[model samples]
Target: MSLDYDLVIIGNSLEASYAAVKAAKLRARVALVLGETETNTYTEIDRSTFNCLTYLDKKGQNLTQWELNYDFVTHLNSSQIQTWITQVKQDIKEYYSPAILADLGIDIIGESGEFCRLPALGFVIKNRTLRSRNYLLAMGSISSIPKIEGLSELGYLTLETLDLENLPYDLIILSQTPIGIELAQSLNHLGKKVTLVVEDSNILPQEDAEAVQLIQAQLEAEGIKLLVNCPITQVRKIEDKKWIQAGNEALETDEIILITKPTPNIKGLNLEGVKVEVQPQQIIVNDKLQTTNPKIYACGSIIGGYSLSNLAKYEANIVIKNAIFYSIFQVNYHPLPFHIFTHPILSRVGLTETQARQSYGDDIIIIKQNYKTLAKAQILDETTGFCKIITRRNGIILGGHIIGNNSDELINFIALSIKNNIKIQQFSQLFPSYYTISEILFQISENWQYQKLQENKFLNNWLETLLFWRRRWKL
Candidate 1:
């Protein structure tokens, strides 16, 4: 069958860009339909830098009596941060422009695309109908706005509308999304009264309790109030204040933000008409990242989760491999860390403490490393969080969860250890670096081995006997 292109990508998101570049490099004819999807890749960085500013501000308050550079952090504001974000966004857009993709031999379609038929499939973009053997649905997701009373007429804000001036002085954030918590902290740091409404007991229910609790303490210390186990039932405008009936209280705030889950943007693709299986929230795909329609595939937010660029890039590669090479490769993300960019940052990989306990029961051993013990954290006045590592009784690592500055970087080493099945005793005890967070892992690894050896009666007796024998022989 003579097809128009080898593949037709249906969005201009990070996943779409990744597919376009890889397909182009593979010498396969590819068409990227930008369509009506407007993308903003700087959202993560924008969220992260605000926390960075907050950290800097805290540091300035603690150490400005002596350090000159630390005193300057007080002058930072939202306007300056926005300008930096705009400049970076411009640089990134130019680097990944449609013209650049075209130079790399990819057909860039400015118009929207719709599926024409199934089994023998093709995408119709305006006057052109590009036929392809396979399709990659990287269109991402639309914000799944909830059906709250007076929410539509009264109006509300979201993670998207952060640039507007005259934003609410007192903001009420609905949930604990990565963006929601980050926005809460940033807005609070920017002089707004931010209240995070968590329906559960913990702020970040997906993470380990210890880590989540530490981050919660940090948030509270920074003046961002957390309203846990408080679910909002109704939202309405009372004169000038936005009021919400949450739990037993009728809380009033200047603005209300619903951090609702995002649903896949598969409505226009007409998947049901073509018999492509889709669940309530996302398109149904197998471990190989293939949809019910073998000729089609989906990734990123279209699969229904947080819209993270790294996850998008990872899933896109999985799609490309299974779709192009005809290989069955299940998506393996065990080693990839799930990070939340809160004030001190939180990162986790593999099984959490609870999950490890459930899986290994009494065989699990938890080793905790405090940031207060690290010279780097003490030097930077970031001695507020800790790293909790879970492992088998005999020292095989099961998980790593950290909450602190540079924790995002420190968790990667433990993730690698878990991925490669490295034992705590097997890891070398030589950490020559001083005043660095990396030493925490080395210190904890040594402690795990020494404690296990010392606690075991048989091992300790055997070592003692060996030492006595060696002394007697004098060899």
Candidate 2:
């Protein structure tokens, strides 16, 4: 077509960067319009350096990649869970440099540019009259402000605002998502009176129900008031008081914060010439990340489905393969692992119990194990959670959910197992040691048999008591 440029990447986010790098490799003349600096911008770090742990392996030697991967999968699984982590780390190390684009003759534009549609070209934008051949829109989502009546009048802060670090507020009301919960908990831990409002019945509702219960208990224990099933009806300001009404009851909070929703940034793009469609807050794309305009593609939070940074990066790679290499590979969303980084984090992949039941009927079996009985969780002194495995009647592991200290890292094991069709019997056969949380999988896998043996209650109690005594005596 011989257009102005090969590809124009609209955002400098993780997904956008990935797409840009892939496009560059295809020898596409690329341009990046970045709103912020690229170095370490999206990475999360622990600010409490004093509490961070530096561990030494049993050999008292440095750990190798194989060691880390072996230990990780030994505790978890070897499927996409490991692949996703490895790819992200590899991508960051190999292609994360901002200067790489410039070195490849890709132009970097600092200011924000809006998209426009012209008669000849299906989609286009003007960077002071310089148009591009293909447009890759990745502006990301904007924070959603609840229609609180007085919120705007009293002033508020969002993730974007809080990211600035200058717009100070005394108190912040947050939602239950990672951004909301993490910020609220962090500020509260730093002496801010933050109240987390969850319209859903529980925090991290998408997580395992048991995980959600454990996290809710932990958050409540931390003195964070969790208002469940109470939607913020109105936010109004009276004099200096910021009043928030949930249903009929009114409460006053100092500041209001809205978490971002999955909304496409195509408002002024003028897509009249293109056949792409957007509903409510997102763009419609097929499994291949292809838009209605066959020649165009989309990825990241703009698509409204799975919006994790890792998922977006995967989608970006898919787009690159399809667009540049003309490969027929499609995006597979099965066994997508996501983590909620609350205090006792929650992580899940595949179907929940509710989902499995609806999809596979009541013949589904759920295996569960407690963390208190696990040696590692007990040793870590964080035994408030458990792992639940959902399987079909024939013993296919459908999903895995974990809610506890290392659930974020551990859920991948279940994800890998499910993705690879690893059966419950195989998992049980591994026979992980007693003290590790991974043992929970083995414990649950054998739970059906244990339940049958529980017919003799007294004998079971006697056996449990004997085991407890033996462990206690050993200690």
| Clash count for each candidate, listed in order shown | 0, 9
lDDT of 2 by residue, 163-273 (tens): 423323455465735556665655554444667777767666665666767777776777777677778777787777677776556777666777645456565555544
Best by lDDT: 1
Per-model lDDT: 0.78, 0.65
Error of 2 at 451 (Å): 6.4
Candidate 1 lDDT score relative to the true structure: 0.78
Q: What residue pairs clash in candidate 2, if any at all?
A: 76-413, 77-413, 143-260, 148-235, 149-235, 150-235, 150-236, 375-435, 376-435
Q: Which stretches of model 2 miss by more than 4 angstroms?
A: 3-7, 26-95, 104-119, 122-134, 163-178, 260-262, 431-435, 448-475
Q: In candidate 1, what are the lDDT values of residues 9-31, reduced to their tens digit?
A: 88867679888898889888888
